[model samples]
Target: MKALFIGGTGTISSAITKQLVEQGCELYLLNRGNRNAALPTGVNLIQADINDEAHVAELIENLAFDVVADFIAFEPAQLERDYRLFKDKTKQFMFISSASAYQTPLSDYRITEGTPLSNPYWQYSRNKIACEDYLMKQYREHGFPITIVRPSHTYDERSIPLGVHGGRGSWQVARRMLANKPVIIHGDGTSLWTMTHNSDFAKGFIGLMGNIHAIGESVHITSDESVTWNQIYEIIADALGVKLNAVHVSSEFLAACSKVDYRGGLLGDKANSVVFDNAKLKRLVPEFVATTRLDQGIKQTVAYILAHPEHQTEDKEFDAWCDKVIQALDAAARSITE
Candidate 1:
């Protein structure tokens, strides 16, 4: 198999890159050469800014691929660019969409490919929905060989996953846990969520490459295991060898208090419980199974982040903001009693 991946060295794509190489797939990664150091031996690198379309066009004009995937494209316009570039060049085109594109305040908690696509709280999810719509239109009208993939709450060793965190990253929340500071969990921390290990995500994704039956289909690859936000936080705390100092906060209040996109990241997505049914993915990729449990994956992540200083970035602003939120809520309680 021959494949071209744009933005290959991300948290999700990195694992796929390694797995594809191990499976004897000829892989080419087109990205700025900033983060490609750990890539496997058989991988080819096309170091260029994908935004530089004219240059990229000149670079890959002579190349044809079995599959071309875009991990960086989020907007409909960006996907339109992909369509123009790879219309006849690749046999298969994959667009990485988001499961958050599913209806917010969901009519049903059980999610499948048949679930309606609608998310008004987050523009990010809306953009993904628009991209999916555009690709499906192309697939139906023009017979474009497109496979839309939705990955929900996928994580790797590079970063810890969390429900409520700042723009900086999830490291700050992990840092708070290490320090025994009260970490925020949106909406009483009981809302169910799914987290897919990127390595496990790779197994399902690799199965779809060059898959004829997957053409013109949209499938979400996620773990069947679902846990509440409280369990998630508790797992992280246990991984770090610390007692969970959890502060339950309303999603609405957090949306109002913070500049972060809590309205979308919380209320639109994480605040609501969601359990993914990977039946479609299993039918397409028979061997697909998510072996990484929450405790297992998070323990590896916690160990890696602690050992590497580069991953432990401190966000004093977010830390102070968390403190402020906790304090204001405490004062309101005192006032109500007095």
Candidate 2:
């Protein structure tokens, strides 16, 4: 099959791209030349900015694809642009949506595709909901072949996955752990969350590429393995060969005090416990299953970051904020005792 990926060099997409190439499918990647090194030897490269419609049109004027997946589209306008660009040029179009688009303060802890789509706290999730709405409309009105895949907290070896992280990246959290500094856990640290490795996510995603039954369906591909926030931090600390100094803090307080918009990441999504039902994904892709446990996945990721100096990014501002929050909370506890 001839497949084209709009943003194939990302953590998730990169894994899918590798699997596609290994499967001997004809693959083409559309992106700037920055991530060319990540592509395998057999894949074709279309080095152009996707925003440059004229350039993209000229390049793909006569080309048709069996499947086209867009990993970079976040807004409704971008999805509209994708619809206009590839409406008639592809047999199947996949939109990478977020599982966070599901209703927040969830009425149901066990999430299925049937879970109502709503999230008021995060504009990011709202935008994804809008994009999904647009695509579903297109599918219903125009019989557009579109498949929606929602991934929850998927990570790769390039970075460790964490619920509470600095604006810069996850490196700072790892840095703090290594330095014996206390790292914050958003809630009591017992809230259930699922983390899927990119390789594991790729298995479910690639199976849906040309899948006929998946065209009109919305499915979220995640690991069935649910771990608590405390366990999540513990896994990361264990990987770093350091003891965790966890400071428990309220998610609401963290959101209020954060300089960046933590409302979306904290209150809207990760703060709530979520366990995904991948039965629909399994039914569609009979071979799909997530096998990577958090401990094993996190260990690989931590090793990668520590080995690569370039990945050790620092965020002093966020570090200072964490320290400030910890100190004030401690002082408050002391005052209460007095």
Candidate 3:
């Protein structure tokens, strides 16, 4: 089987590519050629930006692929372009979406795929829901073979502290606790979070691809276990052996800062709370299991942070905030347990 992957260098895409290669499927990676990553030996790399539909179409025009895994599709225009470009040549098109697409309010802790999508005007969630709707529409209208995978908080070795695929925000809190810094909690830090390891998510994606029955369906890829923010901070503090000193910031403050016209502020707005349900995914991939526990994932993240002291120094304010929150959380947990 021949498969083409978009955004090959990204953490999730990289894991998918590795697994596809190991499965003996001929692989092709398409990207803008800016990121430097080690590709599996003999895999074809095509340098083209999907934003330029004409160029992307021209590059993949002659190639017939059994599967096209789109990891970086965020805009409806891009999804439309890809469908028009490869609808005939590709047997199946898989889109990588986020669990945030669920339309239910953030307070709704357990969200399933059936939930209504958020408003289309909300940038990040809107874009994903739009893309998913476009794909499903195409599938119904033209019998376009497609699969949608919604992943929640994927983390792995390639994960950076604050970048895409960053482990849960709790990692930053843990780092702050270790350094005897003050951590800031947005709201009460009572929200529940569940995360899937990249490797496990990749396995689920591959499993879906191999199963023909999985076509024309959306699946949630998430961890079996869930942890609350308070629990998460306490776990990190225990791991790092630090005292808790944290400030509880009102959610209004976070909301106000997020309203600022800046990328960082916008990101903060979108990341305050996210929760999902993976029951359908679990039912679909019965054999799939997450190997990395939250404790282990946190330990790995802490080790990486300590080894890369430069990162901490570079983001001193952020680091200090993380420390304070973790410490405060730990102290709070101890009080409750006592």
Backbone clash total for model 3 is 10
Residue-wise C-alpha lDDT for candidate 3, range 91-156, written one tens digit per residue:
899999877676535446567877766743247767888899899999999999999988867766
Whole-model alpha-carbon lDDT for candidate 2: 0.93
Please, what is the whole-model Cα lDDT of each candidate in the order they appear? 0.93, 0.93, 0.69
lDDT for predicted candidate 1 compared with the true structure: 0.93
Backbone Cα, N, C clashes tallied per candidate? 0, 0, 10
lDDT of 2 by residue, 1-338 (tens): 99999989998999999999999999999999897885788989999999998899899998999999999999999999899899999999999999999989899999999999999999999999999999999999999999999999999998889888888998999989999999999989999999999999999999898999899999999999999999999999999999999999999999998877889999999999999999999999999988988899999998888899888889999899999999999999999999
Worst 10 residues of 2 by lDDT: 32-41
Spell out the clash pairs found in candidate 3: 176-323, 177-323, 181-324, 182-324, 183-324, 183-325, 244-327, 244-328, 245-327, 245-328
Alpha carbon lDDT at 274, candidate 1: 96
Stronger candidate by TM-score (1 vs 3): 1
Model 2, residue 64: displacement in angstroms?
0.3
Q: Estimate, for each residue in 60-155, the C-alpha lDDT of model 1 and write its tens digit.
A: 999999999999999999988889889989999999999999999799899989999999899999999999999999999999899999999999
TM-score of each: 0.99, 0.98, 0.81
Candidate 1 Cα misplacement greater than 4 A, ranges: none
Candidate 1 differs from the real structure by a C-alpha RMSD in angstroms, to one decimal, of 0.8
